[model samples]
Target chain A: MSNAISLRGLEKTYANGHQALRGIDLDIKHGEIFALLGPNGAGKSTLIGAVCGLVKATGGSIHIDGHELPRQYREARAKVGLVPQEMVNEGFESVLSSVRFSRGLFGKPPAPKLLEQILRDLSLWNKRDDATMTLSGGMRRRVMIAKALAHEPQVLFLDEPTAGVDVELRRDMWAMVRRLRDRGVTIVLTTHYLEEAEEMADRVGVISDGRLLLVENKTDLMARLGRRQLRLQLQQPLTQLPADLAGFPVELVDQGRELVLDVARDNQGIADFLRRLAANDIDFKDLHTSESSLEDIFVELLRKPA
Target chain B: MNFYSIHAIFRFEMARSVRTLMQSLAAPVLATALYFVVFGSAIGSRMAEIGSIPYGSFIVPGLTLLAVLTQSVSNAAFGIYMPRYSGAIYEILSAPLSPTEIVFGYVGAAVVKSMVLAAAILITARVFVPYEVAHPFWAFFILLLCAVSFSMLGFIVGLCVDGWDKLEVVPSLVITPLTFLGGSFYSLNMLPPTWQTISLFNPVVYLVDAFRWAFFDVTEFNPMVDVAFLLGFLLVCIVIVGQIFRTGYRLQH
Candidate 1:
């Protein structure tokens, strides 16, 4: 089946001469939660904007369910929804009205029951009649979600959807997102919190400096590129490493208090390395192995030369 | 793109305006009445009537339009600009609503507001001056056209303006001066030939003339000129506003 969303050589350069996106190529599959991770000015927001038709692409093309954007915008936009990082609405409007009106914008007929279900799913049913301005930060974030879901689009873009929201809202939003994915809705999320991506996304894409670094399945990425560290607490604080053990990728850490060895997750032989350490007369009081985390991989990706 | 969505926004915006009915309607009505008291009746006591109409009646069109102009522009400008100002536009941008829907929602509310104020002023003016409607249909038409025309113009101004400091530029610098020199208080016919020619250049003059012609069947200029000028102005406003929405001007950035 075709991907729900696709971008080819997408380039966006603002009028101020600042390039926000540079040739980004990505495909978000149907019924998958895809997370795009990047630092500030990493062009994540710009990419989402281009897909939603909020920001015009200077070059390249974006296809939503095979419909070209900004031209077949009505159809292209009809299939996608966006939950922006910001909280904004008609202050005097009730949460229900805001969501209902949003659905109508996509030419969807009025469906109060659907709106109520969206509100309830987001835990906003009780506050449906309250002016949005009166809502708390977390509640307001949920309202944004309800508004986006009003049209029941096949694809949803959540741009840092939980950036400043509370933990409860964040968890609820993640659950709802999973439900959306289960219902065959493709989700593209951009988040600063790598843990969110690690916990929620099936596939992850990293972007930096207006460039996409990599896109890979979460588990495969961890197994393929992740590293493991074997940290040995030394029995003695003696200084240097043995010259015979120099060939191995290891380091004398904490001023010789510990011996730290880097093991490639998929390729390295930890058994041989342990034997070599024993044969080298290095004694350790205790040892433990730690796997590289998503944060570690993220930091490592950023440290790579542009 | 759909009418229901536009209607939803329209209803919400109108409800918002009505929620502060006292501040929005009463304050402006009182302010206009004060202007008539100070600038119209008080000053006119010493001055002769410019035309067959009394000075009080002469200034009514200008004063009423001034209120309409300011209120209409502020209502729309603030409605759109505030959303952007407070970062609420992002929520709007994220929604399924098209730019055209957004524009119409705002402009529709502005038209509604000016209409409300126009009606109020018409009733309020009776206490100050005994006014008659020579062409009631024409009077209502002029009121709606002016409201819609200025509201559209204001929508563009809101889109173009940036910060609060910049916001002051349009109403204070542009609208106020145009209304003042537009012949609200005095007619261009009262000016010398040279001043009259200069006053003819002011677009507000036609609006006031059109209104005067509708009300008392008396005007310093041809009614056709007023209709032509306003229609031309309305078209210009629509084109500019349409372009702004199409380009996403300040909104996208």
Candidate 2:
């Protein structure tokens, strides 16, 4: 099957001559959670806006479920939903009415039972009659999701859905997202929390400076781009580097009491690093290895130009 | 164009607006009552009848339309403005709604709100001046038309405006002045012939004259001519606002 969402050479520029997105090309698969990772002003929102027809694309084209945007907008948009970054709703509105109205906006007939099911899924069933402003921040966020899911679109976009939410709510939201994925909803999310992306996304795309730096499967991307660090505790402290250990790519720490070495992600490099440490007669009290996390890779990607 | 969808949106908007009763309905009605007590009873007691109707009755049509006009415009403008301000418009924009549905939903709800206010003012006016509706059907038709037209106008203004201050500008400077000069408290017949001719230039005059004609069966100007003018104004507003929605002017963003 074709990709659920496809972007080709997408470029967006604001009226003030600020370029938001520059020639972004990407494909998101159906039924998978795709995470777009970026820093502030990196065009993650702009990218989602372009797909959902909120922002006009300066150049290039977008296809939603094989339908072109701004031309086939009605059909393309009907299949997708977006949860924006801000908290927006009528404070006086009931949760049920808000979600029901969202369904009506999609030209769907009033379906009270379906709306009830949605509210139930989001754990907002009890608060259905409550005014939105009376609810807590987390509950309001759930209302946003319930509103987006009212029409049961094929794809959903969560833009920092858990920015300031508490731990329990965040975990609950992730579980709900997983349930949606299980039910065949393709989710595209943009988040500053690399850990969320790392835990949820099947494929990850890093965006920086309005350009896409990389798009790879979570496991493959980590294995291919992931780096490991080996910290060796020295037996004796010294003022300067030892002569024999100079050939190894290592840095001294704790006044020569420890050695920090960056090893390739490959299996052989780790073994070779170990062999070299032994050959150099380096005495270490302890050693620990750590793989580079998504946060580390995300920071690195931002520092490098696309 | 689909009635059901528009109805859903219309109902949603109406519920939202009415929920804020203190600001939307009560405040405007109370203000209109004070206007009647101060302007209608005070000044009306001194002024003589104009065109076979008491000054208070003559002003009633204008005041009614004024209530309808401002409330209509504000209901739609604020309804749209709040969503845009709160960033909730993103939710609506991303939904399956078309601009037409969105516009009509908001404008329709505005008309409903203005009508509710009109009803309240009409009832309150009965308490102050025991005036009866001369041609109740015509009166109802004219009020409905005025409400819908101004509500559509407000919808256009709301979509084009960016900030809160911009939202209040059109209603504050334009609608208020137009209603005052539209002969709400005085008759064009009371003015000099030349000024009377100039008064005809005010689009609101046609609405006020037509509304008064519906109630008293008497008007300073020809009722047929005034109706034609009001109908023309309504058509123009519809066309312009419809074009704004069609072109996505200032709204799609």
Per-model DockQ against the true two-chain complex? 0.40, 0.57
Against the true structure, what is model 1's DockQ?
A: 0.40
Error of 2 at A3 (Å): 2.3
Model 2: per-residue Cα lDDT over B56-106, one tens digit each: 777778888888898888878888878877777776677656667777788
Question: How high is each candidate's TM-score?
Answer: 0.89, 0.90
Where model 2 places Cα greater than 4 Å from the true spot, the runs are A237-256, A259-282, B2-4, B33-46, B130-134
Q: What is the C-alpha lDDT of each candidate?
A: 0.84, 0.84
Please write out the lDDT profile of model 1 over residues A1-306, one tens digit for every residue: 667898999999999999999899999888889999999889999999888866878999888898887777767878988887766755787888778777766677889898888888887899988999898888888888888889999999999988987788788888898899889899999998988998999999999989999999999888877888988898888588889878889898898899888988664667887788788777789989998888889999899896
Pick by DockQ: which candidate is best? Answer: 2
Q: Give model 1's docking category.
A: acceptable
lDDT of 2 by residue, A103-160 (tens): 8877778889999998998889999999998999899999999998998889999999
Q: Every prediction's TM-score for the first chain?
A: 0.91, 0.90
